[model samples]
Target: MLPSLAFLIVSCNLQPVSAAGTDVVSCVFPFVFDGRSYSSCTKDGAIDEQLWCGTTSNYDEDGQWKHCSLQEHGGSSGGQPCIFPFVYKNQTYYTCTEEENRGFWCATTRNYDRDHKWSYCADIRLDANPKGPCVFPFIYNQTSYSSCTTDGMSNKKPWCSLTNNYDIDLQWTYCEPSGGKRKRRCEGRWGPFDTPV
Candidate 1:
């Protein structure tokens, strides 16, 4: 007398989430639950192995967690964000996808079949620290910029890319102040490739 799998899944999706209708809260890496340490999201205590993370740095104390995507240790790890239209197993994906019951995941690189880098999609969206590691070759004013720029400005403030390809995950970052540090770290003259486009 069990419900159909599809029905159950639908019901689960309909359940109220504490983070619903709010900006996705970034997961606290290396959290703890049940007297164990977990550097990534876990399904341990969650029904149906749904991935979850602590609202605070420690789960044991907060006891507050929200359902996250079954991402394989996703989020800013290595600063490699998901790139759309990614090639995987001779196929291309324009958005998040599920492979072998691992829930929705995306290739952190443009060619997953090559570098083989990927992570689970976030609970709401594959977004965190929106600035992200600069992806370069990004479009700002309908013009593609392969590197940081201070174009079309009066203050000469430095700027950089946030999206990988502009055509995919096309978005920019906040601040004209902290933007320089991100550029230096990710676009410096030497060893400035924490993120690749």
Candidate 2:
């Protein structure tokens, strides 16, 4: 049997830290899953699992070895979802719902239209497995779309659809940083992209 895994909820246990000049409550715990350690869920695959956090497994005779991001143990049960920082085609992705939260959910892109349902990663389908740091799709200008990993802010212009396969007018929105008017190119098929202007 492998080591027992546990899900540590930081909100349940808070620690006090000084930030700026005021005391702030924080809960930052090292995630240890089945003897594998993870600091944050950021990198792709298991070996690079240490990208956000470090994890090791002794399942093999080689002692504690880092597995691929997707192969790492994340949920409490083998059938449960894997943790964040999973890899797909060598790119590290995060699946958590909130942009700031990091864990197994980052491995797959959540279904933004489906009540925060995480059912796809890099366009691939996932059933019940939720562990992620998954790649998300880029939908722009109501008609352009692409994957976040593939699009780049080239020529100071937003990355547009590279293929004719994507249809414009699907649903596009402009994204601007909070309190700023400069819009950055971003994509999502069915949502409003807004910034505090």
Candidate 3:
């Protein structure tokens, strides 16, 4: 004799996945198998789609799975050291680090004084050396400073803080007026900061 529809479903397409858990199989077609909805094979039943449920305590924390609300390639704060309250393309997202789950800091707040359009926050570091040409208003202590004449501080103590700490006078390369050189480089006359380098 043919069993009842529900009984037939349980026997054929749907089955309890485990004895202790409520998880069961509903359908095999289209890859959705969770038994949350009635079998689509039945009349008046719409196709049930699969929805991702976060892992429970039963699952290992490291092995657990969680659904992300952000779009693919979009920003998120699932990790630590993430940048908070960040917006992109009209959508707000928190910058997260996949390394160990952390939040990110602002570049401007860290004395960057530049754009803040980065996707991650853990990229901040002190050993960063910029290649090629760069704009000014940069911050540097002593070891990083190469020259000081451009900023109008030849004595090095007045311009750079590194020399001031040592209290040493900078050696100034002066040009003699009787040397017949009409142009002044660093000695008597002031140079133009507005001049393009």
- The 0-to-1 C-alpha lDDT of every candidate, in the order given, reads 0.52, 0.29, 0.25
* Candidate ranking (lDDT, best to worst): 1, 2, 3
List where candidate 2 sits over 4 angstroms from the true fold: 1-65, 71-110, 119-156, 159-197
Residue 41 lDDT (model 2): 39
Residue 144 alpha-carbon offset, candidate 3, angstroms: 29
The TM-score that candidate 1 achieves is: 0.32
> Backbone clashes in each candidate structure, one number apiece?
2, 42, 13
Backbone clashes in model 3? 13
Candidate 1 per-residue lDDT over residues 1-197, each given as its tens digit: 33322343366553423542232445655576666766556667665556666656666665556676433344333425667546777654555555545545678887888977876666444322333344556776677886666664355545455565444544443223333344243212212222222
lDDT-superior candidate, 1 or 3 = 1
- The full ranking of all candidates by TM-score, starting with the best, is 1, 2, 3
Alpha carbon deviation, residue 194, candidate 3 (Å) = 60
Which pairs, if any, clash in model 1?
71-120, 72-120
Q: Candidates 2 and 3: which is better by TM-score?
A: 2
Top of the candidates by lDDT: 1
Error of 2 at 20 (Å): 38
**Candidate 3, 49-134: lDDT as tens digits:** 22222232221122222221122121232222323323333322222212223222222111122334332332211011111111
